[model samples]
Target: MSATVFAGALFAGPVLAGPLRANANDVPLADIPALVLPALGETLIMVGIVMAVVVVVGVPLGAIIHNLARDGLFPNPSLHSALSWIVSVGRSLPFLILMVAIIPFTRLLTGTNIGIAAAVVPMSVAGIAFFTRIVENSLRSVPPSLVKVAKSSGGSSFQIIRTAQLGEAVPSLIGGLTINTIAMIEYSAIAGTIGAGGIGYVAITYGYQRFDNQVMLATIIILVALVAAVQVIGDALVRLTTPHSSTASDRRFARKVARLDIESANAASPV
Candidate 1:
């Protein structure tokens, strides 16, 4: 009776082990090239599109907001107040919640709620709002006296913004852009919840659902590398644009312009 029981137990062990081996991801290492390349491409595409839209729309929107506020070149308190409120509301929402809330809008724009195109809508919207605030803050950091110098020289509002404000703020703006771009990459991953095909989607479908830890780890590593590359490039650009002597000269010029602007304002006032 003992011998017979041992034989039955030995047979059952192999049978149970067979299913566990089969359940593990086959060719997980081999599948890396096939899966990661395409998913990485999709991620880049989504982030690229969202960033393009954000730069084109958000930069101008921020500039307009900056120029319209009090102490700006052309203050319009009511308009600035309204636009500021809109931006604040946009910036306050969490990205995931924003995605769900904009489903109807996304569907309207893309005609489908489950692909890269649809994902771009919410991503771009969020990117725009976030980057606009970054740009507004960057522009505000430019010495106010720069605007005064441009005005005293008879420079138009547009010229002052283009040549004085944005020109001076380029280094800070590039830093903001780098931060915004990284944020969009994160948003792209969240977008994968809706079947937007990117590394995130791959991680979810294959890594989490199928229990493939290899794939999940690979995706994470690739994302880290990509963000690091962006940061390096962004820092390089900022360094290239900001020369020390120019920055010092700018500070000096701003101080002189500020004193002159104050004197001119005092003389022009009706006491």
Candidate 2:
């Protein structure tokens, strides 16, 4: 099984490369840079806009949903269920259908539903729904015991969320954002068929249609580099924000309380 899996992975790249490189000599080398940069820029624009909208919209929505337990503000099961259904329906729509279905509205807003701007509308909307679930999951991972501790100490819902819950989940939330950003890149490629100008568009226009294999190969290399850069930066940020392994403030506090209990027990023991 292991060997089979390895063999499959090994052969996949060459199989894909063969067709991509079949007519490599026909593409103009001079046009490669021009195509590459514009495509890269369009991808960045789409992803950036989507990321911004997701953060602005998803985080607040998640915070609200996370606060929907019996002890939460406005703890109505009906409302919670309704909202969950809506979010679920949003998530259930296939991406391609959602893109096409939203074209009329996208056209109205962007003035041309067949370009990069139009693509952004659907991409951003999809991202908001998708990342909201991620944010909600991250927030929910904050332990109930921790929330109780904060409440026992007179913390309000907002205060507890602001000080403890969000702080505890920052690392995970950052990680999710990194993953979502990578996903946005993949979606941008898919959006190319609808006239979204990215490396994907370049691939379809030159590689598939014109049979310019060189353009296709170069575009693939550029995408690989872009994804690599995002991953490296994300990893560095994750490492930087995470607490040092040597830090034991939580353990020290527990120990201090335990020592006090021991001293009290010794004093109360019969002579």
Candidate 3:
């Protein structure tokens, strides 16, 4: 009975869904190229704007938080605690909830609370808090020894952070950014619910709503391709920026090679 019901549900999904089958034939092959291409461009623009806003705001905010010394400049435990709490609250909110909750702000910015412009508000807000944490974590991971060395060389706190800490933290920060960008792509789908047009919107409007399985399948393929492309680019960037092997590993390999050479010399000399 359960198997029969499951099969029925799967078979009935397209029939029961209205928009899923709407005038798909009305969408010309030529029009598809025009529609999808422009949508892709809009999505990229939205992502770029959000990424820039988040980075600009998040990086400085994180730097300030990470640099909070026990007795240094701008030392305010209460402020730090408050900002951290705010970030926590933002992260805890589901993306859809955040989108709906910020509708008024979206209206204020975009005048209609719909489309790529409206999507930017919630997406960028969520991104700022999310990326701030990543930035903070990466900055914190910078070696204390490097900072100490900089100080011993008569470097100021600002100089140490600018020259040593940030330089060392770049690879990790880039990695975090890469991951965050990918996540934002996935999150952008929720923006479609509020009438933001992306491939996800295309999928729903012309596929799920219209019962066009081909369109849904095509959208999924495009999304998967986008994700794979991001991963490949991120990996290439990490390899280009980061050290591949540890100094200790290199030292160990050198020692093993030297020992083998010495053994070979002894064997030839005596045996």
Candidate 4:
């Protein structure tokens, strides 16, 4: 069993022993990073590549799809509906199924179906589909009057999309982007079934197979922290991009406080 397990180490992560000993149940916490860091790096690289492709392809694809709607500047209902259905199909499939089903395509593109390169193809497909909708929804949220203004000023269709639609939708798009990114990170882990290197591989090998409670616990913690950090950063960017992301009541209270401060100063001054 031990030899057979080591033989399939490609699916599992590197066997840590010689200098960096990891004993799942009995290993020192310090040695866990040796096993986990490389996995984390793989996850990051996979997600990063997927997002870059999503942004490059999905953003424009979304813009094109949205602009084909009856209410859009171009207004082509047939094209819009067809594109919409296509995107819907992409989103409807579960990621795991998407990965497995697309193995042939993945192999055709990457020339191998057992590494980060193979993982990227399915992830990119799913992510592009997911984010195209996000971009569309974000663009939809833009006020119609913004489009009207752009048109009334003699803006071209492309200009309207760039300056009026996408530019105005920055905050919402960022929020959607943040959500998509976290989802892709999860997909990368699920991509582990193909022997894609990531935190998921670590969990399966060290935690699940080896019964390494400590390593499993660490993976969980790291996953949570990674997600929280993305959310925090994304929220910060959204707030920064928005003109006045604060509540109306907050603004009103601030004005009231300023007024009171002025009154108090006047009262304190001599006649």
| Model 2 spans > 4 angstroms off | 1-25, 71-74, 245-271
Error of 1 at 8 (Å): 29
Q: What is the C-alpha lDDT profile of model 4 across 67-144, one tens digit per residue?
A: 999888898999899999989999999999999999999999989998899999999999999999999999999999
- Tens digits of per-residue lDDT, candidate 2, 3-114, equal 3234445665854644434343554677778878888888898889889988998887877777775665447777777777778877888877888888988988889977
Reference-based lDDT, each prediction? 0.86, 0.78, 0.77, 0.87
Sort the candidates on TM-score, descending order: 4, 1, 3, 2
How displaced is residue 194 in candidate 3, in Å?
1.3
Ranking by lDDT: 4, 1, 2, 3
lDDT string, candidate 3, 5-124, tens digits: 344456657566443333436455446667676766767777888899988998877777776644333467877878888888889899999999989988888898888989989998
Model 1 spans with C-alpha error above 4 angstroms:
1-23, 245-271
Q: After aligning candidate 3 to the native by TM-score, how far in Å is the CA of 75 from where it should be?
A: 3.8
Per-residue lDDT for 104 in model 2?
86
Please report, as a residue range, the 10-residue window in candidate 3 with the lowest summed lDDT: 1-10
Candidate 2 TM-score over all chains jointly: 0.77
lDDT tens digits, residue span 116-185, model 1 = 9999999999999999999999999999888889999999999999988999999999999999999988
Residue 224, candidate 2: Cα error in Å is: 1.8
Q: Candidates 1 and 3: which is better by lDDT?
A: 1
